[model samples]
Target: MVAVVTKRYQILQYVSWMEPVGRRSLADQMHVSERIMRTDIDFLRQQGLLDSSKSGVVLTARGRDVFTSMDQFMNEMLGVQDSEKQLAERLGIDHVLIVPGDADQSARVLDDMGTALAQTMQVMLPLGEQIIAVMGGTTLARAASRMNFQLSAGRELTFVPARGGVGETVAIQANSVAAAMAQSTGGTYRVLYIPENVSEETYQPLLNEPSVKEVLALIDKSSVVIHSVGEALAMAERRRMSDDILQLLRDHHAVAEAFGTFFDAAGNVVYKIPKIGLRIKDLDQIPYVFAIAGGQSKAQAIQAYMQHAPKQTWLITDAGAAQSILMG
Candidate 1:
């Protein structure tokens, strides 16, 4: 009976994401036969939760409500609540929100995680003007993409890139993420165009630039921050770091990278990349700090960084990373 309910919940969840989707496509995605899927579809339609059209099946207004409530219900039934508390205590974080499924396994899971972040911001953001400093990465970009106008309807919010650009894909760069988020949420954004890692000779000159100084000031005043964690070597390689810098990370046994700081398993700062923007230590001053990352592969990196994370940091991740860290 429990298994049946779980399957039905998954079907509703997937349909909510991919409405107007065919039975064959849904079955293929769910890894089930069309005949079995048809049975579930018929049951849902009979219950008035789903309606069929020339295109495909879509949820009724009631179905939408049920889907929302069902998500919370299923999470509780599946022990996600227990996992959240346990993971938060174990990692010494102020809070932890673990969404269902492994993002690494399904693209929809990543989308769900993004939706979760937007929902959290709606509740945590206080009245009056607020600046949110955001970091770059595929994960952060997905979250930004999920942001809707309602997130900033009554709030005065400015989104600024937490750091300068890295040698990463253009869309996932800090500047891009900030812009996308601003556009989606009806907020304004400031861009920082300098390279994330720069030479000592160029650092001071860039800092003195009027444009850079303006953004830096906003970043320093930011009340909330949203960023992602990365595996140390993976991040270093993505930035196209020099061989010496790469070797330094390996030599120090760096396990994770967040913002510009790298940490080893012991949560010691193994290295700090030269960058202009929010430093990890500065998080202590911010009222709201959200570190978002997930995937079973990232369990170690998440565990390592959270060791040195601020006491106020709220980690938003998926079950894959949480289970891996807790079960280990």
Candidate 2:
């Protein structure tokens, strides 16, 4: 079958390039086992394409031909570029699927990113196991809008607002975005009812309330987090930050805003709003953190978030943002 051929071909390619590699190493790389590698190797050897010696196993002359064909196929499939691949690598992300163009092309890029993300989620997440924690923003809302709920059948998932966005505009509020995503995925949701920028006095009290407390507890348990980075200047304007706070951020050259916190490109805390929602410590506990944002304007924001983000965080952005990020 074509499926079986594809699997064996992949194994051969890995062994040929990573040859002199032991059974354990092959198993580890393929996330399989020594047994599986041995079986595949035996099959390859029988095909006369692989030869085994006392030292280790390697490709035979015939094997090299097969390796060349497979290598060419892989190159064609992954023929983006070294520079772009390096950008993804530098971000320490698993994959960076970029759509070409600039800020003016953001709508098309966002559509493509959303569709790709929806497809990726369908593949990466198993049925009845997804737990998404989301932030609210225009880009995120668009992404959620494009999700295919039919692909999530039998999934027992819940979407929770990553932070409070009660006072934010409807389109960019955490609760609104989470609810939209939940609706799109045919899942349920829990909202952070409290405002993102409540007074310190109000914040402590709200956190003690049973309703808010329950949502915060759920957020802590979330395994996946999806959020958008915000430019500090734009977010300050949106939040109506005090003139003094704005001045402080400008003085420090603050570039990004995340979960009510602002940071400069160097990862220094420029300013913070006392919000009653998920804390930075809580973000670290999640296994998958997807920071989704795009456009040249969001480059600095994305960079600043990447600097302070948890090591496991994965960034999803477009070519414009990626190029701007490298330039910065």
Candidate 3:
């Protein structure tokens, strides 16, 4: 009976993450033979827990409900709820929401954490004239995609890029992240088309441009700000920074990077990129700040960055990161 339950859970879990994947591929992923895995697939299809088409297997509405309903149960079972409390207490953050699973172990956990953030934002977003500032990163991109936006209907929302993004992928750029979230919610968005790294001489004049001026004004008025934290070295690698800049970050013992600023374990600014958008200090003025991140690998980064987080910040992370943070 336990074996049956586990098999069923694995079937739903794999299908949830790798939908449209073939039966053979699923067998390979689960490390089971197709002949044996066939039984599990058949059970789900027969129970109407999955829709298996030539296109591939997908969860039905009922299946998704069954899957989602397990969120709390899994969190409790994994002691994630307790971990969240511990994390909030340790980090001095007002709230910490932890989704089940570690993103580092399972790609689906990232999706789960993203869903949690989107749901929270849907509830917390104000009713009128809301300006949302968003940071760019893969985690935030996933959050944007997972947004159901059902509750945001009839609400006015304007999304703005929190910082310029030059070397990053277009999909993870602050402009693209803002656009994606706005598109999902049927809201408006403004872009700040400037490189993330620039000299003070170049940044001062660009901020004065009419197009840049418009977006900057919106960012300044943002009521809610959403962003992701990154390990300083990882972010530097992503940006393809110069050796000198990388050395400087290391020399300062930078642990986390956010809003174009790097901070050490003590939360002091170690380095700053003169991006023409929102700054870390600017978050103090924003009423609602949402910091979305996950993965055990990012635990230190999250811890380091949150030291500078505003009092109103809401942290949404997965159990993997939370557990790792506590362990350290």
Candidate 4:
């Protein structure tokens, strides 16, 4: 009986995440046979929790309510509720939200983190005019994609890139992430066109550009900031940093990279890339800062970065990362 309840809960959860989903597709995702899936679907239909059509199946009004309540129940059942509190207390951060599964083992976990982030924003976002600064990266790009149009329904929000491009893939650049988030949430976006790894000679000149200044101003006044943490060595290699800078990070034992700043396990700044946009110190003044990163491999990086994170920063991570940190 307990097993049956767990299966039904899993079905409801998946359906909620991917509504209008076909039976075969859902079965494939759940790794169950079509015969078994059919049985469960029929049971749910009889319960008036599901409405099926030729195209796909979705939750009925009662189903939606049940699923919403079930989410909290499942979190408690899985011990995530306790883990979230313990993690927050241990890390000394404002808050922590952990989704199930290890992102390192499954790509779907990343999408789930994105969903969690969207739901979190819905509750935390205040009304009235607001500016949101967002940093770019693979995790953030995926997470921001899950934000819906309704996120901006009652608020006047503008999304601005936290920094300039850092020679990463275009899809994961700060400007691109900001634009995608703005489109997803029905908000406006401002771009910073300067390069992230700028030299002293060119830094001031680019910062003086009217376009750059405009976006910088928005970032400075941002009420909320959404960004991701990255493994230090990987980020350095991705940015194609010079041999000397790479050596410096290794010598300093850098473990994490965020918003162009690299930190060691102790949270001491190892290096900071010269560029225009929001600085680490600037987060103190921002009302809300969302740092989203996961995967077991990122545990050290997440911890290293959080050590320097502002008091108001909220971390959204996965069980993989959270458990690793807790274990250590």
Candidate 5:
């Protein structure tokens, strides 16, 4: 009986929300053919759970009771609540949101994590003018795309790239991500065009440029910083680092990379590229810092970086990563 109810639970829940909805519509929403749905609908109908008519289908009183009762069970089935609590305590983060699935195995999981990030920003963003510093990465780019327009409603927002990112592809660069976020949320943005990986000689001169200085000032004033962490080797590859630098990361047993600096599992800075941008120490100043990443593959990197992450930081990851961390 439990197995039967669980199998058809989604159908009942959907019908409850969209009462008087046609079976054709329900089938479409559930991504199933009418033939496939008929069997469950018939079984549910015979069990006095839901009624189908020429007009549509609606849950019976008993069906509504069952659906309501199973709401928590649905969430529990995904194990999100337990994972969220455990991950936050272990990581010492202020908040943690764990979505279901391994993002590396499922693109949809990444999309879902992006949605979770947008929702977190909505809650964390405080009143008054907000300067949001964003970092470059594929994860952040997905987040920028999924940002809701309502995020801009009745708010003042200015998005700025957290650092220079000339080393990355344009699509996932901080500049592009900041601009995309502003556009989606109906806000404004500033761009930083300096190279992310620059030597001390070139870095000093770029700081003298008025435009660069202006953006740097905005970054300093940013109230919130949104960024993602990467595995050291993967990030070094993304930046197209020299073979010598790659070898250095390997030699140091670097496990995580953030803000142009690589770290081992114990959070010691193995090496840092002289990039003109947000430093890890700066996070202590920002009232809100959101670190978003998922996939079990990132569990080691996330754990490594969180060792040094600010206590105020909010981590958004998936169940796969969370479980992996707790298992350790």
Candidate 6:
């Protein structure tokens, strides 16, 4: 067991920093010979801690849990000194988990939140036969990483991306994010193969396609929806909004954006981007809506989203953002 523990620790440490890496790099980092590193890696593979391919190595789903648990244990044992907890409590959220360091330290905090959110979905969602709708963002991507496929057993859950591509980054698109989450949960996924913003004339024709209509119908029937909130300015920048629309947002004092619609704190629609995806009214039909966002910068945007969210919605956010919301 001593050998097993040491190998696990070594593999965990290496993957934590040098993820998507190869066995050769792991050996070089540990200063161990290639032969020994190979042996250690093989052991970890047998234990399901390391997933290796011809290209590189990544932590398996099980391995992520081990690493996350260790980090959380160390942080709690060392104690957190951050002042963000007060902010979380004031926001009326269920719980606020804070990482006691700066943005660099908060990566793990975000990871933890993702894991918790995934676990929550696993426990709360009905086994099989549920439709889950998801939106895309950096926060949701992180949450996707911590999720595991084991939690979806005996469930026939179908995931559909709530919107379309926002920017050039393929990873942050709703279709890609929805696919990732579906894979993590051992469920199937459907992609919305269109941009978030399109002209009304373009959308009308696209809606006539059989595939688009099918996905749209599924989105309307979703029982649970998971999403991330975004600041209006940031989203505008991401979507490459026209100068006229930017000025319109400024005129309306828009603070937050969700599902192609921008809103101010009062829940009034500032502007609506013509996007070919799920409508805000569809969210109203869902029984459960889970909104996850973090970082101090997103506080106002999250607050704006909360103002418009249904009464049964649940929010998952970090202490940093929570504090900002409370202060505002």
Best by TM-score: 4
**Stretch of 10 with least lDDT, candidate 4:** 72-81
TM-score of every candidate = 0.77, 0.74, 0.75, 0.77, 0.76, 0.69
**Candidate 2 ranges with C-alpha deviation above 4 Å:** 1-77, 81-84, 92-94
Residue range 57-113, candidate 2, lDDT tens digits: 777876676556456434432454454466666665544545566544648778666
Error of 2 at 123 (Å): 1.6
Give the per-residue lDDT of model 5 (tens digit) for 67-110. Answer: 66556545554456566667888998767877778989998887
Q: Is 3 or 4 the stronger prediction by lDDT?
A: 4
RMSD, candidate 6, Å: 12.2
Tens digit per residue, CA lDDT, model 1, 1-328: 2355567778878889999888898899889999999998887675556788889888988667657855764675467757777898999986777788887898777777787777666545655698999999999999998888766745788999988778898999989999999999899999999875678788869889999999999999999999999999999999898899999999999999998789998888998888778888899899989888999988999999998789878788888998899999
TM-score, prediction 2: 0.74
- Which pairs clash in model 6? 128-155, 128-156
User: Once all C-alphas are superposed, what RMSD does model 3 give against the true structure?
Assistant: 12.6
Badly placed stretches (over 4 Å) of model 1 are 1-79
Candidate 2: worst 10 consecutive residues by lDDT? 72-81
In order, what lDDT does every prediction score? 0.84, 0.72, 0.80, 0.84, 0.82, 0.71
Give per-residue CA lDDT, model 4, range 1-328, as digits (tens): 2245458878988899999999998899999999999989987776567899987999988778657855864564456657877888788886787888899999888888888777666545666788999988899889877888656755788999988778899999998998999999899998888876768798888777888888888888899999999999999999899999999999999999998999999999999998778888889988888999999999999988888889777788888999999999
Instruction: Give per-candidate clash totals.
Output: 0, 2, 0, 0, 0, 2
Off by over 4 Å in 4: 1-79
Candidate 1 or 3, higher TM-score?
1
Clashing residue pairs found in predicted model 3: none
